[model samples]
Target: MGRSLVRHPGVRGCYTAGNKRFLQLNELDELRMDVYENVKLYKEWTKQWHDSKITRKEIIVGDKVLLFNSRFQLFPRNLRSRWSGPFEVVTVFPYGSFELKNNKGECLKVNGHRVKYFYEGQPIQARGELELEDLPSLWDE
Candidate 1:
């Protein structure tokens, strides 16, 4: 009865089958590790590419700049301007911070990223003089 129970299909034994399964498990582990390493490398490359695209703004004291209006984002207006300053830069601090002075003589500290340089346009030249009758009266009878 014991001899009949020990029948084999091929020349390989039970030990060889167990050994092959062990080797396959080790190969699978190595493949998983390789995939993890490739993912990490891809993440680092993407971060470097994204960081390179950002442009750094150079700000200095006494420069005129416009402050970005973040409050307007909540109440959207198509015709309104989002930037609201020709503020003077009173002082510049380290790590992209600036102290700005508005027209009302009020000074506030803000991040440099929120501000951009304001470019002044050319002044308008008067073509001709107007008579007193042409001027609109402020008071009406």
Candidate 2:
């Protein structure tokens, strides 16, 4: 009698390659899991480092500040000044909003991120004192 090519002893099993492929697939899955864990760890470490370097800024009411002006009619030129105001802070909301008063007594509400503290001895000119005729006459068409 010819010996049967049985995989399981005494039970005549077919030679299906499923078991070998299953072991290879399991090994691949474990390798992928390891890579995912490493990426997660790297992201956490970077977040910690970035947070540690940031210093919180606190602004109180009555502090003098300069507002950053980003609005320009055309493409911005490097020579043009962008910082506009030595405005006094009238109110600072718990959320980052500020009420500012200029020398002309005009009040404006702007985001706190656009403002910075005005230090002493800075040369902020007195533009409020100038009359309409002293500057360009817009109505002379």
TM-score of every model?
A: 0.64, 0.63
Q: Can you list the residue pairs that collide in candidate 1? A: none
Q: Looking at model 1, which ten-residue stretch has the lowest summed lDDT? A: 1-10
List the global CA lDDT of all models. Answer: 0.86, 0.83
- Clash tally, candidates in order: 0, 0
Local error of candidate 1 at residue 90 (angstroms): 0.6
- Model 1 agreement with the true structure over 43-123: per-residue lDDT tens digits: 999999999999888778889999988773656889988899999999999999999999999999999888999988998
Cα deviation of 13 in candidate 2 (Å)?
Answer: 18
Off by over 4 Å in 1: 1-28, 72-74, 123-141
CA lDDT for candidate 1: 0.86
